[model samples]
Target: MSIPIDDLPDIPADLIDEIKAFLRLDHDEDDPAIAEMAGSASLLCESFTRQLLVARMAQDMLPVKNVWQKLSRLPVQAIDLVESVAADGLTQELSSDDYIVDIDSDGQGWIRLQTAVSVSRVRVSYAAGLVADWEEVPTMLRQGIVRMTGYFYANRDSNDVHQLPHAVSALWRPYRRMRMG
Candidate 1:
């Protein structure tokens, strides 16, 4: 499994004024709550899409199976380490020449092994994401978060809320990573 090593996303709050405009509210009044909700929406969007909305370091402990293995996150910027884990779950550095990482913005890439080993664990440390900050997050994703925040805020009284709204989903769909069988 892969684990994010970054602190809470340095993702900036969505533009409160933009949200206010979308809601058709008077410009003079500010809904401070939208800032917090926007952050939540961004995190939720990241979680739902399994794509990091901001750039940061991450690690994954995966069993080295077959000659190819997918890295934990897509849009991987760099690979810091490739280690072997012992039966006791301890990590030790491995030579970089043993494998090659192929990554792309589409988030479809894998490590190609040069030689097989009996070790059951391989740990990968890498930096991956669309951008390093909220400002750099894709326009559609930022818009989606705003849309979601607005949806949640407007639907605060609704009892049955289970998924992201259609508009928000459409905006995020293109960025979502597709699984191949």
Candidate 2:
């Protein structure tokens, strides 16, 4: 499960302007609408890649089945707090000494506990993402987002927003995080 602690980052002004230029709009009348489309496009790319383009804080409720448990989010930047939640809704915060964070070869996040946990579940508040800033996002992802936004703008009057262009997927496919069952 994912619980976002803050609002997602907005599409940068420069990028918005770039999209407007792609749409060949010299006027700012539709700037807000364009920005919204850009934001949606960014999220679409992020979802397809299963990666967060910007750093974000989120909490995950995970089962305590072993000493080391994999976190739901990848590229975990930092662990803010870890607590065990009881059936009655009480929470016990774990100490730093109780567990350690580990990043596997695949960049997956894991938390190793010194001892096995008795709790059925734990809530971990963590920061995770691929880049710290929007500017740090890869060029391919940015271009994919721009293209998707342009597509959305072009099809605003129809049901075509549900359709994702092949080019956008091609650009973002390399960054997709493959999950195994």
Candidate 3:
């Protein structure tokens, strides 16, 4: 499992303006609300694609199944720390010489231990994402997020809606990572 160690970045002001323009709004009264909706849209995009939209610190815990293990998030920028947690509640930080880290061409992260160790789980802290800033995010993703924000704003009163529009899903499908158990 992977846990975010930092809060998601706030929606950029330019994005809020773009969403407002897309909705053809003439007022700034709802800027804060729209920002919130945009944030939600970003989360939906991330969730649907199974990828982080911006750079951030994250921690992952994996069972010691073999000499190597895959980190949950992809496009890993760097591995900051790796620790082995023993069954008796002891933890040992692994040095650089103890393991090797690789991000494959597919953008998945892999860590391989150079030596054998008895442990129940491994804890990894790393940075992973597709882009470092909102402007660096893919154009399709930004467009989808804008449209989704409009959808959310327009349908705010409808409590029955539970899924993203087909267009949004279509825009994000190509970026979706296939997860396997």
Candidate 4:
């Protein structure tokens, strides 16, 4: 179900042309139009190159697996445990915390976790859940919660961008509470 970069919508020719024009490639002889074009092309090329590298890395790291199919094979009790934990409603019986948890279909064929909690005020956020790989569940849970808490702790170092882990942790806390309860 994954769409390759080639399958994505084409970048607009007008935008490219506008970018080219904005660089003022036709100006001075020392910094001529050709040099400007080359500079612009180089920038664009580098962006695409980085994107491809990241895509490849992600593909290599995350292999395709039939998560739902495997989950379906679990015993009814185990399946219920997963459902309840994922749903987050089971937290109420275990804690008096005013938190609401919900699941969302990511449209890309995965489920995500959303949480709304009231401290001094109501705060809401969401976290992307891991693919249904039971073996990766523990690590994924930790990572996903961190991400939802607004902290970007990916396995690999990214382009110097740090995500907020607090938001991710907030979203995932309920699920953890439910499981323990």
Which candidate should be chosen as best, given TM-score against the real structure?
Answer: 2
Q: Candidate 2, residue 143: CA error in Å?
A: 0.4
lDDT score for candidate 4 against the true structure: 0.26
TM-score of each: 0.80, 0.91, 0.90, 0.20
Query: In candidate 3, which residue pairs clash?
Result: none
**Pairs of colliding residues, candidate 1:** none
Tens-place lDDT per residue, model 1, 44-99, is 88877778878889888878765777886767888888888889877778787777
Q: Look at candidate 3 and tell me the lDDT of residue 138.
A: 98
lDDT of 3 by residue, 1-181 (tens): 8878977898899999999999999899999999999999998888889888998888998776556688887678888998998887688998788788888887788988776668878888999889999999999999999999999999999997788799998888889998887
* Poorest stretch of ten by lDDT in candidate 3: 61-70
lDDT of 4 by residue, 1-181 (tens): 1222222122233433433354443434423333343333322322322221111111001122223211111011111111212233232211313222223231111222233322212111111223232233344343332232122212224576443345444434443312122
How many clashing pairs per prediction, in order? 0, 0, 0, 17
Model 1 TM-score on a 0 to 1 scale: 0.80
Candidate 4 structure, TM-score to reference: 0.20
Which window of ten consecutive residues has the lowest lDDT sum in model 2? 107-116
Candidate 2 lDDT at 102 equals: 80
TM-score-superior candidate, 3 or 4: 3
